[model samples]
Target chain A: MQTPASFEYERATSVEGAIASLQRLGSGARIIAGGHSLLPMMKLRLANPEHLIDINDLAELSYIREQGDELSIGALTRHVELEKSELLARHFPLFRDAENVIADPVVRNRGTIGGSLCQADAAEDLSAVCSAVKAKAVIRGAGGERVVGMEDFHIGPYVTAVGEGEMLTEVRIPLRPGGGSAHEKVERRAGDWAIAAASAAVWIEGGKIADVGVALGAVGPTTIHLSRAEELLRGKAPSEGLFAQAGEIASADCSPSADGRGPIDYKRHLASVLTTRALSRATARALHQEA
Target chain B: MHVSISVNGEQVSREIEPRQLLVHFIRETPDLTGTHWGCDTSNCGACVVQMDGQPVKSCTILAAMCEGHEIRTVESLEVDGQLDPIQMGFHEQHALQCGFCTPGMLMTARALLDENPNPTDLEIRTAISGGICRCTGYKNIVSAVRWAAEYEAAAKQEV
Candidate 1:
């Protein structure tokens, strides 16, 4: 029947109330946002939490705002919102790129950013997208709010820094000048997970790359952050050769295993090509040459 | 757990387990088998239903979480023997051969036309990307949605 194991469910009225419930219930308590990612896992019996804290009622948490030096996206924001957010498109088009390819519109309607990040599936798109944008995860708990980088936010596959009682409240993408980001993914079908996806962001200043972030999905145990490629791209002039070089670095850094998606060699090749494509597109956008 | 959800247009309360999926709840409560339960995973949109005006895969949603929300199933598409334009369009275009994916496709198309009244062929295809139709190769299904859009638009213009 593919039904989840019996558990208790309650709607959370506020973030504080949700935290309190988690505190009371301890580690066995989990929050249900859109249930697109979580419920499927639950039905498969991969996730058997004793309590599900329904956060759909927490309307105050759904928002996308540009405040101070960063763009703050609330955790409750859905995939459809990200796909349609003009503000996000203006700053980081990679979000729209990833959202369009995340899943079908029906699943996107109910899935939330918080839930996708918390699910932390290695093959998932958003984790790599967030990492390529250098976004910060805002985790709320009894100790108030703590912001952690994507590197630390994701501890491993299906594992995150969100502790027993902590809930991810928002993701903050730093507003960097001359920055453009793109996500390149090749899935087997319309809504399937990527065989290997690459997300790349480049910031150009004085015709040279000021900073860059590149990450890959479905190729490693966790979202593979190409720190070596990022370091290699900094302060370099944007060019096809440089991007290809960075792609080579990305191909070598990612640790992929063979499965239905492809052989290990094919995945590494896809990763390299996608990295180059993303970097080329990102560079074009940063230089304002995108059509 | 006791959950009260407005199904179609009626407020029906039912006692359901926390893990009970919404598809099962609807089928068992109102006896609306029109919403087919295919792929218990969210991959198949056969269980697509409107939750407060948006189409969502009911298989992945817990009925307990649907409390106080409005759910619209395919059973509500026909009113007093007058079929919804989407259903009629499907019939007219021969959109279904096996009929397993019709309900989900119809509901998904309903939501698409609601948000985007005049969806292009590409848009229609994108909207129903979650739905899998093993028959007609989706050419007829796409035409069916387009026909509904035209039908609804014409009806609006006449009004």
Candidate 2:
């Protein structure tokens, strides 16, 4: 008997049209892409938007391609596409890894990256994956579009930088040479949210770690950036010892509360172990040691 | 709101509340009750149906959102009194203990076989991972999908 509260629905013909609907409807209006996340929340009465602007027909906003020095992923790109994209697999294998475990294949077919990120659930994987790769979110509104870093994209749990009249249009990841990325997650069962997940991206130069990004999911109110761990890994040579030290930082930094998934201590432990494994795999790929 | 959707290749129009889910629409509008509504949440795939040839959880989708899209329910699996290979496989393999999860399983397996004519046991398991059988009849269900895969592959070869 779960159902959303009564609301007006409109199909947007174009991105501009969707934005116009949102602007006209004001704060109560929500842009629904894929509707996997939003509809579930609506059913539970956790979300009660007065108007829903369906953006599923905006096929022009569905793509994954390389533009200039970055990889541009259209916000409407379905999770199935992300999981199957050889382009994404070749450049950022972490996307494939995260997508593989995001949900069951059937659910993935209907879920979109934009909706996943905009939902801003701490247990969701893509937000942590995007944070680890230093991806920038492109938000479009009736006025114009603005790009925001992943760190700033999430305001809090279930809150995003996408404003009243705005929607996320794309995510841009800067393509750097000698870079590799990987994601690791531990969940209780199939299609379940992560108890604790870690995503790591490493760029090696001269046999040393030139830059690194490490983030954790389901371990905090928002995606944990792991600046402490990143700072610890920078300039260090790829080694098991260095990664183990970084894992310690991840374990210490994340703030996880106890729930059905696990206790706080267990989640912290998972954060550490998953971080080390992700870093190890990422560095191995960066050095071309593993595919 | 008035919503028109192609259910089983036939246009079914109705005046439903915008909040009405696609599963309820399918059952109440066209009287296609083969698609069960379970878990009301998306966790249980009992409400699964094919949208534009891909399996989606109908319980999580709004009827308003399905306007103009083609939705195939479990009832579509049988045409002219001939069951889909997936349904036949389910029958031969005894895939259902209670039959509550059968409709969703059939549609999910049908969509998987349509996309991948030959799926390994692991692939079949992965494809239906969204579904939960309280009876825990997954072993037979996986066998049913594999049986259907082989049946379709062999049928295509003969053609």
**Model 1 C-alpha lDDT per residue in residues B1-159, reported as the tens digit of each score:** 888889998987887888899999998974788999999989889999999999999999989888889999999999999999999999999999999998899999999999999999999999999999887899999999999999999999999
lDDT of 2 by residue, A147-255 (tens): 9999999899999999888999999999999999999999999889999999999999999999999999999999899999999899989999899999999999999
Q: Per-residue lDDT for A72 in model 2?
A: 97
Error of 2 at A206 (Å): 1.1
**True-vs-predicted CA distance for residue B37, candidate 1, Å:** 0.5
TM-score of chain A of 1: 0.99
In terms of lDDT, the poorest run of 10 residues in model 1 chain A is A36-45
Candidate 1 residue runs with Cα over 4 Å from true position: none
Chain B alone, TM-score, model 1 = 0.97
Best by DockQ: 1
Global fold similarity of model 2 (TM-score)? 0.98
The lDDT values for all models are 0.93, 0.93
Worst 10 residues of 2 chain A by lDDT: A36-45
Residue pairs with colliding backbones in model 2 are: none
Share of true Cα-Cα contacts across chains kept by each model? 0.96, 0.93
Q: What is the interface RMSD of each candidate, in Å?
A: 0.6, 0.8
DockQ of 2: 0.89
